[model samples]
Target chain A: MLAAAVRLFNERGYDATSMFDIAESLGITKSSVYHHISGKEQLLQMAMDRALDGLFEAADEVRALDVPAPERLERLVRRSVLVLAERFEYVTVLLRVRGNTEAEQHALSRRRDFDTIVTDLVKQAQAEGGVRPDIDPATVARLILGMVNSLTEWYRPRTGGAEAIADALTRIAFEGLRTE
Target chain B: MLAAAVRLFNERGYDATSMFDIAESLGITKSSVYHHISGKEQLLQMAMDRALDGLFEAADEVRALDVPAPERLERLVRRSVLVLAERFEYVTVLLRVRGNTEAEQHALSRRRDFDTIVTDLVKQAQAEGGVRPDIDPATVARLILGMVNSLTEWYRPRTGGAEAIADALTRIAFEGLRTE
Candidate 1:
């Protein structure tokens, strides 16, 4: 039911969808949707939460490990690809949210939390003299995240498995896009 | 008038913006806008074209230069930043266009032309043996473009100039975030 709602919301857009459309898709009464959860906004929030939580949790585990910053960055990329593939729909919805709704507000906050983790990693790498010091931490954070997030815009499972996509990202980002 | 129109289209949405609103913002009659342009769609398309043309032209000039791959890449990044910043509003509208309209279809074709130019640069860099060998050209292309394209979402010019941003992106991407 939740998946159906997300699909509908994505197709018609969040603002255009109604409880009636969701209930019809589920072949249940509108009241039944109420019984399952508070309402549409809550459902949207939960969907976003599911996607956002995976990112934050994966980032945390990667941060906790005792690996080199490069390897840790690689692992972070790999895990993100896996999570994005596994929960593609939910994450896609989360990306599309523009902070217009209540659920979107929370998602943005969670996004910032994830960003903080990446910022710390960049700083650590810079301190160790691997990363560049000339650029601001926040800008690098945005660039890295933007590269990964662009995956949602066009990447499909048909290109390769989650792992391959992750590996490609890591290689290109670290080694530059030249023949060496 | 143009700035107001771009803001309304970006915020409320392109489809939602009407001639009356633009005319009202300019303190002019709706017919005056029609005299300047055929209609709203023309305005949107023209705005996007102006922004995109800057990128295409800059990339062409950078490609023609005799610099090494890495330095050329740095120039590309700096010029891209300047183009985006100088034509901030038009670029913002261009970034947000989802290709949902006929004008957007044209916009996308022009976008593809721009991509083809950048892809050629990636190929040139790879042949020069400055970039890595393991990654595919297409993947790297998307990654680099994605990183730079994301600047449209948050970059403000007064705080930082094109030179700093370009240097930072080039450094992080070429050197990796890992301390070696």
Candidate 2:
């Protein structure tokens, strides 16, 4: 049901979609939707949770690892790529969010928290001399995760090589694209 | 008028925004909007053209440069960052397009053309041994431009340092974030 609703929200812009449309798409009555879900915002919260929770879980695990910051950052990027491929619809909706509603505002706040984690990791890496220090750590964090998040836009789960894509991203991000 | 429409479209999803809303936002009558423009879509087209033309013009100039493929790629990335920052609202709208209308489909096609040019440049750089050959050229192009495009999500034109942003992006993209 959440999957069906997210698909509808992603297909038609979330604001354009409503209980009636979601119910119609699911071939159930609107009352059935109301019985299962509080409102469309609840469904949105669930969908975004599916994406954000996956990311935070991965970040938590990465944070616990007793490794250098750059290594931890690499692992986080890889895990994120897999999560994005695994929860493609949810991430799509999450990425499109623009803080128009309470649910969106909550998601945006959580997203900022996630970004701060990456920024801290960048700072740690720079402090340890594993990452370059010239660029602002916040900017570096945004660009690196920005590359990872772009996967939600074009990556197809059916194509099924999240590991390879993650590897490619980490390689280019850390090693530079120019030949050594 | 186009600026007002683009701003509204960016704030409100394009589908949810109406000509009346645009007119009201601009403190003009709906007919006044129709008189100046054919409709909302013509405005969208003009706004998108503002972004796409800037990119293609930059690409044309980069193509004429007698430099190595990697050098051309770096120049293109720098110039694209400038174009994106210069036409901030237009690029935001351009990136959000999802092919729901004739105008949007046209914009998507032009965007694909631009992507193809970047992909070809990546391939040329790989063939010239200027870029690493391990990763797919298309993926490399997407990831690199994806980093640049992410600026629209968080970049504030009011902060006013496009040159510094461009330099930071180029350094991270080409030299990467890891210290040698």
Candidate 3:
């Protein structure tokens, strides 16, 4: 039922989706949905919470590693792609939120927290004088994530294989866009 | 009125918006809206079309120049950030569309055309031995765009300075995560 709601919300969007529509999608009663969850708000919260858990947990793992920043950041990118692939719909919903609702604002805040962790890693890498010093660490973090996050926007799970996507991202990200 | 619609759609969403609500926001009647455009579909198409025009034209200008590939790419990035800042809401809508409508599919096709143009440039740069040879040009094109496109998700025209944003993006994208 929850998966059905997430799919509908993702497909039709959150506000455009109604409880009745969700009920129809699941072939269950709206009351049955209420029995499973308090309301639509709770459903969004639950789905967002699950998505955040995967993302922030990846951040935590990246932070726990006491390696050089590049290696750590590479792991961050790889782990992120893995997580994005695993929880595709949930993370897609999380990324597509526009912060119009309190639930969305909460999700946005959590996303910012994760962004900050990546920013710190970029900063650490910059401080080591290994990464380019010309760019803002925060912007670099966003740049890395933008590539990874865009995967959700286009990648079909079966097309070109998962490892291929991960490999392409890792190479483009870690290596400078220079012929060497 | 279009501004209000863009603002509202960006704030809420495209599908969630109605002509009634748009009319309400502008203190005008539904008939008054028809005086301007046919309906929501035309409005969305116009807005997105303008945004695409600016982007592809900039890409064309950069391509026509005799500058080095990397420099051309930088100018391309700068121009892109300008469009994102200038056509903020329309581009935001264009980026967020899921291709559920005919107009949306057109927008997506145009977007693909733009990507292909940029990808060809990346291929040229790589072949010239300017960019990394191993990474796919398509992925690199997307990665560069990933930085600029992300600005829509967070950039506020009034709050954020366009030059700084553009410069930061250019620096991050070209120089990369390592401190040189």
What is the docking quality class of candidate 1?
medium
lDDT against the true structure, each candidate: 0.78, 0.90, 0.82
- Maximum-lDDT candidate: 2
Docking class of 2: medium
> What are the per-residue Cα lDDT tens digits for candidate 3 across A36-132?
7888888888889988999889988888888888778778888888888888888888998878799999999999988898889878877776766
Instruction: For model 1, state the Cα shift of residue A35 in Å.
Output: 4.4
Worst 10 residues of 3 chain B by lDDT: B171-180
Highest TM-score: which candidate? 2
How far residue B2's Cα lies from its native spot in candidate 3, in Å, is 3.0
Candidate 1, residues B67-140, lDDT tens digits: the string is 98756765786687678878877888997777889889899888878777766766767777786656666777
Residue pairs with backbone atoms closer than 3 Å in model 1 (clashes):
A178-B131, A178-B132, A179-B131
- Evaluate residue B27 in candidate 3 and report its C-alpha lDDT on the 0 to 100 scale: 95
Error (Å) of candidate 2 at residue B44 is 0.4
Candidate 2: lDDT of B137? 88
Query: What share of the reference contacts survives in each candidate?
Result: 0.59, 0.68, 0.48
